[model samples]
Target: MTSTAINFNQVAYLLITGASRGIGQRMAIETSRKFKPGSIVVLLARSASGLESTRAEILECNPHINVVTSSVDLSNASKQLLEDIIDKSLSKTPVGSFELAAIIHNVGTIGNVERKAVDMSDRQEWEEYFATNLFTVGVLNSCFLQKFRECAKKLVVNVTSKACLVPFKSMGFYCAGKAAREMYFKVLADEENDLVVLNYSPGPVDTDMTVDIQGRSNAEEIRNYFKGLRETTTILTTHQTTEKFISILEAGRFSSGDHVDYYD
Candidate 1:
């Protein structure tokens, strides 16, 4: 892996999706503290109240930082709608006002983990899954690039998963979505040499999603695997995983587009 120096102190425009709770909320608040005063932080999610809670916490951390929260349903949003949301969020602060522009694509769905691969015959189901996990990501990244093209440094982060490489039975939708999303960012990195793109796998953190998987996965082995992590007290807390994530961003090492894990 290669290392590059990133100045975290610079004024920045940071946008994070799925910022209502879990890793996204934690990351949004933690990363906000690292920015200079007058920096902008845009939080997007379906839950309006949750985003407000995140915004409140961010303001509490640094009242000087500008925080904008928008409720967006990524699952069914049209490309034009996504672009409009981006425009509305970015309009809170002037365009050429930041030295660094970064977006963390943390929004996603687990899909129907109860259904196995052979049962996944509905094209609508697949399209909905890809809409949230893949299509919106590409649309948002393209809009971000165009809006912040003048920034001195650009960072794009895809919150990827180990499932992207390793298959998990009964998790066909989730695994496939993650795999496609990861490759999407890798290609983005290849095409945009000046951008710093990272596919970060935050490991099995103790979140509601993990709890859902533990109880809901159709595969007994998969359920047991997550249950074991919880039982052993090995599942990482949101704060713990966010600490590692922040360190990785601050360090700015690892070649762009490399799939870096929390353990790594």
Candidate 2:
């Protein structure tokens, strides 16, 4: 089938991490609305309650769409969650085909405090941040890329942060981790494969994480920065960001090495 022939209804599956809130939750709902009935969506989060709520919301939007929820702490790099998902895909049900159309890596973390370079004394904290943000993306990419390689259309959309491109003070660890994850896709896009990988920054949104960060010490300065960003940058609602992402995925506009900003 041609790329255009791959409609939402024909999509076999969509696996998304951190789907309980923020960009992940919005993306799940958007995918459900855009895709055809009976398309399965696997939602992963650390909160079982939140995952169930998200699944319920998606089902309400499209009852015919199959929603599966998994509560797992992605911060644990040793857990082969991605591998397990691929293994399950291989064991098809009697009713449908076994294929994953897309995988969205939206898992992430923010440090508890904004620390200066000299204040970052704990090496383990940095390691923990990398484990959650960078390592998990690598694991998922390896798993999904292998599983979907033979399929006609496969895509990986990583929801990264603007910090990957422009560094912000006190967010060194977070920036480092995000940069690493973005670079992974940068290299993977060059590999000859059926998969299309794209690293995307969703810009700033009115999310819980952003609110918490804004509540920190430099609140005034941060608020001013955001105000300036609103004037100079394109701040997207979760819905708008999700819509653009789906458009890009459906259009097959993504290449291996491109870094996409949600504002654009």
TM-score each candidate.
0.96, 0.86
lDDT of 1 by residue, 1-91 (tens): 2234456687889999999999999999998988898788999999999999999999998888889888989887777886777687667
Pairs that collide in candidate 2 are 8-36, 9-36, 189-256
Cα lDDT tens digits, model 2, 1-264, are 133223565646788999999899998887777666657788888989988988999888888867888788888845366678656644564223534478889988877446765678898987787888887778777776666666666767778878888877667777777888888887776664555677778778767777667656233676566666567755557887887777766676655556888776
Error of 1 at 229 (Å): 0.9
Cα-lDDT of candidate 1 = 0.88
lDDT measured at residue 210 in model 2 versus the true structure, 0 to 100: 71
| Model 2 residue 49 CA deviation in Å | 1.2
Task: Report the C-alpha displacement of residue 219, candidate 2, in angstroms.
Answer: 7.7
* Model 2 vs. true fold: TM: 0.86
